[model samples]
Target: MSAIRHALTTKRADDFSAWYQEVISAADMAEESGVRGCMVIKPWGYGIWERIQRLMDDRIKAAGVQNCYFPIFIPLKNFEREASHVDGFAKEMAVVTHHRLIADGKGGLIPDPEAKLEEPLVVRPTSETIIGDAMARWIQSWRDLPLLTNQWANVVRWEMRTRMFLRTSEFLWQEGHTAHATREDALEETHRALEMYRACAEDDLALPVIAGEKPENERFPGAVETWSIEAMMQDGKALQAGTSHYLGTNFAHAAGIQYQDKEGGQQFCHTTSWGVSTRLIGGVIMTHGDDDGLRVPPRIAPHQVVIIPMLRETPEDEALLDYCEDLRKLVAAQAALGEPVRVLLDKKPGKAAAKRWDWVRKGAPLIVEVGPRDMAEGNVAVLRRDRLWNQDNGKPAFSFVSREDFSAQAPALLEAIQQALYDEARERRDANVTRGVTSMDQVAAHFADNHARPGWVEVQWSKPTSAALEAATEQLKALKLTIRNVPRDAEPADGTCIFTGAPATERILVARAY
Candidate 1:
């Protein structure tokens, strides 16, 4: 037990990255896999993911998006239909060159030389091609214009480097594909999906995010426009939490998706796609986590409250255990009475304090410890994770409330914690964001110094040509800065291009992204 306890880091301030790995591993959330760029999420971690899926799934269904499935393989011809899309994902595709393999008879395997496919199949990096092909076959009239469908599946992208929940080679996600009769309808769907992403991120996950359109260069391939929700992590870096794209009939035109209108005129169907992935787990970990461990919001925590039994080898211990059993029954009853809370009683022995620490590290919002002292007094010791410095010294800070009266207070306390986490994250986001007039040189300086202020800097480009934009992008890359977006409402500034001193237009957000 000491070895296990020592294996985990104690100070989040000393080494955040190390602490993160410790917390994730100690909580039995995930484990490194033999496969490069892959991880095995333990039951505890999968429970959290399931909770997220439940909430988001309900919301998506309520928004009139029907769930569906599509084939994971796309023929090479289908992939090349949209040149831009192919170009964007060509480097990362995992191609299936053969359909069969046979034994070599020497304790080895060999690809069957005669089992060549007519055309290579590419494991989908995204489902746009296959979904578009199906849409083309199903739609023949304007009445079938607005097709909304969603799929929960795994996608593979051969990444250079991978983090467990952040950027694995294979990850689970929900992607929405919609078709509309006109560009206006497609654009509306894009914005609506963005709003839903924000709502789920902010309200359900308790993470504050900024929503805006991506710059032309950063937009999705084959998309007229792309928008995203950018979340600021605790380490002062930005995470692209989710994205929604407005295709403007690009895919439809490429895949021959056409519909006849009321006037007997045939037109291509406008299209949109949006998705949020497991990367959200990483966002939540970084957003609300502290030095102790993860501090998950009650709204999404798999278990909102944990009860730790402080046992001993005595009659008093037996009495306390009995009391704990009673208390568990009481809490369970309250939960069954429409309390919207899930509680667990941990009865492991050895070190009660250490067990409490473990639960706190797991981000359980409320912890209750039953001991002989409390049993003698006919009460229980309650610990609140959200309250800062509950005691004067600020060491192991918490109030010891009576078990009998806890049900009345626990619900409100959990709600307050949920709200406070959001408020705190919002404040940090506002404080870190910096805005001002500047040149490309100044933008470089700000990012290099680790000053997030200039959350987004306002600069004018003398000439907004592709070459000029490329030069600006190169400069930013050198300085470790990337353009987040080019505001749609940007007006001509009274200055030259920040990089080339050419005539410039509106302000844009330039930051280092994850």
Candidate 2:
């Protein structure tokens, strides 16, 4: 049997929820924080997010957006600027009522009401309100126009129900806020930003997504339109990977972000905001994970290749250790992402088998084992996480390749694993997407029947509205299904709404989401 085959206690097919939690625990990725609804991303997990940050920040900068920091606390009055916008976030906001903590002489510290400020402050649920206020002050003319800025920061929302990386009271993310003098320019910026998100999700994270405009009921509050990239997880659930929004002067109107036009008249700037949070870590975890553990995409994995040296206290063991060290340097010096390839040489004194299993649970894309025998053969044993899940397909836990061949194949292997993960996810999605369904009963049956990994079904709807879909809301909720998106790439189709019987022209994606 493959050494890492039985590492996980649960089968993904038997109990997916428990399997997911187990994978996170076994992988040592993240854990609950002392504060409710917050998470402490361990080094292994944070390392992956750091890779994501580097890749995403580079892409954001290339798109001409500058990074900046914003105050974490906003005055309560700021939220009142855009009533609808603040209304959307009011329930999740964390408010600061007192300025100091004092001993109440009961052996516990209490909030000092006497030190309260004139107005309460809100911990940033989102930066749109405060950023909009800043834009109002920064803009004076059309030349000072498009204030394109992004901030990599932590935000707090009082989430009642929370998960580690998916939904937390506090999480790390990048929120982009941009202002444009013209509506056309603002919309273009919005689209470009969303494309960046799609590029990052698909190209780097190896998660395939359907890019589309959200239904009105699902659009971000105060956004004229919200564009999103939604990816299907292995368990047949949709994960909203990222989003972009066009504000259409709504925030500008509220915050007084105006600029003098070429004709010397003042006009409100059209605005846009978009963000992707740490929730993406969860998306990646679910998208490519299997019964064994996380099959983290190489582009985002902290360590692309981890080399384990199978050593012993023998005269020849020194040579094997030397070979492993040399191989590490050789692999680390090679460039794949324009940065040094992250390589780890596991030299801890322990059982080689256990060490091998350790990296397997960690989901390092490639694991190489070098031993005295391997040194004599001029080759190394390679264990790929992407391939470890395929033991049932008659594949070995690890394969043997010449040292030279392995070094040469290092970059290609990473790319191959990356592409394979994406292709597999896409295949799962395509296989389950039901077609030519024209009735609410059919839709419900499709969702209910996929067993454990029920996936998405693309249905053509004439009237793609919440009201139209809500006709079967009770039945659909019983099935735990909802419309994922009105795909921007959806081609014109001839059909009617399954429930409303309205003439349909576009396809809507339906699935249960995370």
RMSD per candidate (Å) reads 3.7, 2.1
User: Which residue window of length 10 is worst by lDDT in model 1?
Assistant: 1-10
Q: Give the alpha carbon lDDT tens digit for every residue of 1-514 in model 1.
A: 1112232455655665677777787777889999988889887678788878888888889889999999889888898899999899999988988878999999888888889888999988899999999999989999886999999999999999888888998898999999999999999999999999989999888898878777777889999999998888776777889899999888998899999999999999999999999899888887888766778888778777788878776667777777888877776666421246788878777688888877777778888877777777877777777653334444555567778788667777788888999999999887876666466656767766644243545555543547766877888888777777654445546666677765666556667677
Q: Which ten-residue region of model 2 has the weakest summed lDDT?
A: 389-398
Best-fitting candidate, scored by TM-score: 2
TM-score to native of every candidate shown: 0.90, 0.95
Given candidate 1, what's the lDDT at residue 292? 65
Cα lDDT listed for each candidate: 0.80, 0.86
Would you give me the overall lDDT of model 2? 0.86
